[model samples]
Target: MPPSVRRSVEQRADSVGFIAVKRAANAIAEAARDSNSVRLSGAEHTAAYLLTRMPATYAASCKVLDELRGVPVASVLDIGAGGGSAALAAHEKFPLAREITLVERDPLLAEAAREWLPAAHILAGDLRRMTTFPPHDLVIAAWSLGDLPAATVARLWEAARVALVVIEPGTLRGAAFVRKVREELLAAGAHMAAPCPAAMPCPMVEPDWCYFAARVELSSMQRRIQGGDLSYQDERFSYVALVRDPVGLPRARILRRPRHHPGLIELDVCTAQGRRSERATKRRDRDAFRAARHAEWGGAV
Candidate 1:
């Protein structure tokens, strides 16, 4: 990530959601301790999905905030504020906010965050156990909700006043997380933030159906790590997010011949959050990125 992006991410690490990112990153790092394979693969996989959906995700989050009657987010809370990038975006977008509290669990990472992040109020503790909670009008959890025990998320949302945003991976696991939160939030009476995955026979039809993207500007470090030399347009990957209401249903703009890939859904960027349609990919190009890495040497991802 660039200094600007890194700076942006670090600036907003005060929220619990953003804090949890370090813990999750630690987990992934641990899982891939042998090599950078796990981290690299995971990052690439996730970026792919988030890049394309950035517009939608960004729009949805803002929409959710709006539905909350435009609450003045004086104090904000980011759970799983990994690297505080998302928090930074929020900070950039909402600067007048008084305080941004990031709650991260990993003490090592939290300490690192202190050195790396000088702007936000970074705190360390298991968010699930938090009591006597501080006042925070906004709460965000992107790609972190799935790692947390389901009950923990329910407990935290009870404190959220203005809005609660949960970004999950665009996979079965991600899909499940999205559903779980949507159900839990509705049960808790939280309002809907984003539209449910509309349409059926999801594009992730067969071999090539599992991917998502986020629009992001990459940093030289990220570019180097990813073995790239240019600015990333749409970071692509496979992702799935759970929302508050109407459960996410797949929405297809133009139906193409569905492909089958065992457990994948064949789909594309059709009606991007109701904006535009996209072309579905052919089977050969589905998992093309998989051959780029190796477990011994980055898993040829």
Candidate 2:
């Protein structure tokens, strides 16, 4: 999270107190384990999310949006925008974005988003009932759409003038949701923009799923709220980006963190043809070995 956003979140969280935020954070975590939708029914819940979850989500959003560096994103619409984390990340990625909009069901969260992004248009309503949405260059649903039906994804795709990105938890269920959306959009003529090297059916089998981890810096307040001593946390997430038109996609995407061995690095990647293992050995290819040594999970190879 940026310093400005971090300060703002701290200011809000300070008012709720540590004990209140801690309790709310635990409740929120428990609820998330059981349901797909976020439950922000009170101020404490909202404050807890801002302090504990927003930073990780923002970090993940930044990482995911980085893949769209070359894409022209003049406008962005964040559905189910909780505290405007994804929207804030979008603004950072596309500073020239002319228009920004956010849809949130929880009034408290909607107001919080408005406070965070004063220039954005905030819609305080349920996304499930919304019949239509304004078209935008990029439409993102971060940690959203897991519970929504396939028709919701179609609606979101229709509103996406350039691309549609859906992010979810890294659990098996989350991977299933992402795969479902990917197959649906690909069948509708959409092309891959990130993560997937090809549009072919996901070669990943049932036991092994596709997911990535984003490391996030934890604020002091967040550390207390989470009751953790670590200064950083790894947030696992699964996402798919579908563009309206064909784009230059990567030849292969590293599926997991590279494994370092004696003078060699092992990479599990998804290629245009299928999934396979590629090796980079210092004795064979110094350049590739150097790149693989610095390679991160979910990066292009």
lDDT of model 2, residue 89: 95
The lDDT values for all models are: 0.46, 0.90
lDDT of 2 at 65: 95
Show the lowest summed lDDT stretch of 10 residues, model 2: 220-229
lDDT of 1 by residue, 1-301 (tens): 3255344343333232332434443455365333212222343323322222223344333423332333456667767664454455556456676678777765543444455446679877766677634546667765455666777776567656665666555555565556666666666666543333342223333333333444555534334434556676453223222233333232332222233345343432344344232222334455532321111110101
lDDT of 2 by residue, 1-301 (tens): 7787788888888998888988999998998887768678788999899888888889899999999888999999999999989999999999999799999888888888887689999888888898888899999999988999888899999999999999999989999999999998999989999889989889999898999999998888777766758999999999998897788888899999989999999999999899999999999899999989888889997
Residue ranges of candidate 2 with Cα displaced over 4 Å:
none
The C-alpha TM-scores of every prediction are: 0.54, 0.98
Give the lowest summed-lDDT range of ten residues in model 1: 292-301
Could you say which candidate leads in TM-score?
Answer: 2
